[model samples]
Target: MYVPPAFKDDEVESIRATICSAGVANLVTATADGPIATPLPLFLDETEGEHGVLYGHLAKANPQWRSAPTGEALAIFMGPEAYVTPSWYATKQETGKVVPTWNYITVHAYGPVEFFQEPERLLEVVTRLTNIHEKSRAKPWAVSDAPAGFIASLLRGIIGVRIPVTRFEGKRKMSQNRPEADRIGVAAGLAACEKPQDREMASLIPIPA
Candidate 1:
């Protein structure tokens, strides 16, 4: 990520929070057949390593798992994003100098990825992943809710992925480069947007006191 000093976000805890909050993420790997990527929901185990550990799974039939990754893999977590128009900048009236840009948060995590098909570990991964998503439902579901034989058979068709994070880089581009007046204008414009995501981004802007 090409983050300028004004846009950089080096806060480790903040970065971890962003990744955990992302509903879905892209897991990417470099392979002999170019690059392969998978979109999946992942959970973090923070106690495992200096950075942390990530857990997820993909269909056993997915070629991404079959393909051998040459080195470390990358997981991209994207957060709230909003467009900032030049018209939203107060400076546009004075010098017509403002340009459009985007404000958002992102995290790139790198680590060695290990793929496994062990029934025991896969069952654990599936159950935990199920619980994470089902926790918010009116009627939450559980891995054990399904027939034991059926669930076991289903688990056989997939593989678990563990990436022990070696490093994490985060970026929060929230209009820090803009002057105070311009930033305030942009915030006001985004705050008025109908989309919750835009309003969310607007709230992230650091307003000068």
Candidate 2:
């Protein structure tokens, strides 16, 4: 990612928060045949390694898991994002020099990938993942809700994945590079828009100290 100095996000805690909030990520791997990717919901085991470990599952029929990745795999997480029109900038009225831009947050995690088929590991991973997404619901479900034989059969159709994160690159582009007046205009414009993401981006616009 080409992040300018003004937009770089270096805080580890903030990065972790963004990843969790994203809920889904694009997992990419390069193989002898070509590059392939999958959109997956991953769980972060923050206690496992220096930067924490990522766990997920893929369909057994997905060839990406069976192919040997040539190098480190990448997981991309995206957060709130919205389009910024030139009309949102005060500079457009003052000097007519501003152009359209985008405001967003994202994180990239890279590490060696491991694929496993151990039933016990798969069961544990699926249980934890289910709990994470279901905890907020009024009637949360559990793996135990299914019959043991049925659950085992379901697990057999998927392969477990683990990636010990070796590094993370995070970026937050929220009009930090704009002048105070222009940024304020952007915030006000986004806040008044009907789109949920636009309103969310409005809250992230940086205020001058």
Q: Give Cα-based local distance difference scores for all models.
A: 0.91, 0.94
Q: Identify the candidate with maximal lDDT.
A: 2
- lDDT (C-alpha) at residue 9 in model 2: 96
lDDT of 2 by residue, 88-171 (tens): 888998899988998999999999999999999999999999999999999999999999999999999999999999999999
Badly placed stretches (over 4 Å) of model 1 are none
The residue ranges of model 2 lying beyond 4 angstroms of the native Cα positions read none
User: Model 1: which ten-residue window has the lowest total lDDT?
Assistant: 1-10
Q: Against the true structure, what is each candidate's TM-score?
A: 0.96, 0.97
Q: How accurate is candidate 1 locally (lDDT)?
A: 0.91
Give the winner by TM-score.
Answer: 2
- Tens digits of per-residue lDDT, candidate 1, 1-209, equal 68788877789889988987899999999999899999999888898999889999999889998899999999999999988899998899999976788889999999999999999999999998889888999999899989999999998899899999998888999889889998899889999999999999988888865
Report clash pairs, candidate 1.
none
